[model samples]
Target: MPTDIAFLAIAEAQQLYHWLPAALELARRPDVRVSILSPSDQILALVESYDPTGSLRRVRLRRPPSRPDSLFRQPSRLATLLLNYPTIARFPTLVTTEISSAWLRRVPGFRSRLILIKHGAGDREGGYKKRHRDFDLTLVAGEKDRRRMIDRGLCTAETVAVGGYPKFDLKADRQRFFPDDKPVLLYNPHFDPALSSWINHGPAMLAALESLTDWNVIIAPHTKLAIKAPPIVSSAPHIRVDMGSRHSIDMSYTMSADVYLGDVSSQVYEFLIQPRPCIFLNLDHRDASGDAFAHWKLGQVIERADALPQALARANDLQPGFVAAQEAAMQQSIDLSPVPASQRQADLILNFAKKGV
Candidate 1:
């Protein structure tokens, strides 16, 4: 009997990268029937690139033709899911990287198991919530998340599994995005208006980077930040402002950049895989003593845009001092087992399907 497994890639194109590795890994199993449900053709095409032989089935979900605002799209998408519930319910296991899928549990007569593969390993407060506990099974990045979720009374150890960060399994080339050989600085800001540096300091930071001719800058904010605001323009040849480009999510910048600059985005963790120099924007004036700002311990924290140039110049010298802290943060944020994360995720899903939690 074929085990029906559905992987929901129902977010923007950028989100596809988060779920792609594990989906491709599971699709290789002969005993599993894997399907991808997405709204974007671009995402579907990207998925096909991994499974070129068409082994994985693709399900197209309908979106409003007008591209209504997200406030309206959520309900519309939910309606589409409900309309297609008959088909979705057929699958015994429904895996998704999106938290919204927790709503599926409320659907009448829908018995499919909901598994959540977290998209990123960031210290953002949103990671631990009541909705997380709703999932039948959640694949976390490491022991840190497991403990946090369990301690917060969000979920139990029985329902949560640690499988590391699946996105780390994705491989990308490190060709510098810029023409010159100058050190590359990736300034990645989160989408949250409250904590993001982009809302207030982004333009100033870009201007500051433009003044510093010694470094090539890549201004890649979270996809949602771009959606909320207009494109950031730059006249400098060394500065590349990329808003949700395919390369932004594919780890190209993370791999190529020599220095990481960000405010509350988990991409910092991805860049820290090699333990490079990092500069964190302290936009919220967060106290270093608090647990929420623990990520700041891995980098030099700057509160003013005027201080960035000096920070950039000294990043290389300052990086070595933080290597130990970066490694500790990486261990807490990601679980790198001897076995590949994708394979571990595949085995966990298969075992869950064989025996329910």
Candidate 2:
């Protein structure tokens, strides 16, 4: 029997990258029926961008009904889910990147199997929430997360599979953002209020990056922060500040950039894909020995924004020193497979649904 599967792109557009590839991979199969659901046209359009070959069909889910500005600032995601509950309840298996979907279980007579795909491979404590156990099946991008989950008693080795990063399945279009061919530095920060380098250092960091006359800088933070981020005007022509454009989420900056500058964002893993120069900001002077700060070992760590220039100056020279470690980390974290990650992940999901084990 063909398993009815739906991939939820109902979250932020940035998260859609994590699950859509696997959904597209499953679309090519005759035994698995796949549907892509989203409330944002931006998300739907992004889905089509990835499927230029026209392999998957999309359903534009309706957002909550309009209300006055005084009543509703923006529609809640949960409202969208509740409004579409009747339609969402029809699928036997639902694959999503957000854990907030656990709300589906509280609905009366809802029996759909829920699967969580890791969106960002980060070490923040928020990554291992207790609600994670609510899912019937969980798919992770790497062994690093699997080990963390098990160590936290969230799952056993048998409960999770070492599925590779699905975002890697995205083909890069490589948009050239700058006119001169100077090396590009992508300064991506996480949105987590507690761990984000942006909440405290964002404005000043912008000032620091704006002053860089030698290197081209791309200020692309996490999509969640983009929701209410203040407008930033850059004086330098080479300093391109992208709060959250489609290019920010579509691997454009990751592929185009030559160096990575960040604090605690998992996009660093994506940046490390090419093993270029990397510099991490520890401006607040956090303990380096802590598990949350473990990934800082991948590159040079600076204590202040003014140090950014010096760090970038020596990034390439110090890059070769860290390349071997970066390669080893990526090897242990992401499962590099002969078969594409999306195919492996989709096969695991469909097989899990079919066996009902």
TM-score top scorer: 1
lDDT of candidate model 2 versus the reference: 0.81
Clash-forming residue pairs, model 1: none
lDDT of 2 by residue, 1-357 (tens): 677788877777778778888888888888777888877666677788778877776877777874421111335668878999988888888889988888888899998899889777776777888878778888887888898888988777777787898888884766789888888989888777766777877777877898888889888887777544565568788898777667887789999999999988888888878789888988888887876777799999998898899899888889889999998878777877878888999888888878762
The best candidate in terms of lDDT: 2
The residue-level lDDT of candidate 2 at 238 comes to 82
Residue pair clashes in candidate 2: none
lDDT of every predicted structure (CA atoms): 0.80, 0.81
> Which residue runs of candidate 1 sit more than 4 Å off their true CA positions?
65-76
Consecutive 10-residue window with the lowest summed lDDT within model 1: 68-77
Encode model 1's per-residue lDDT on 51-120: one tens digit a residue. Answer: 8789889987665454642311232456656666776777888888877777788878778889888778
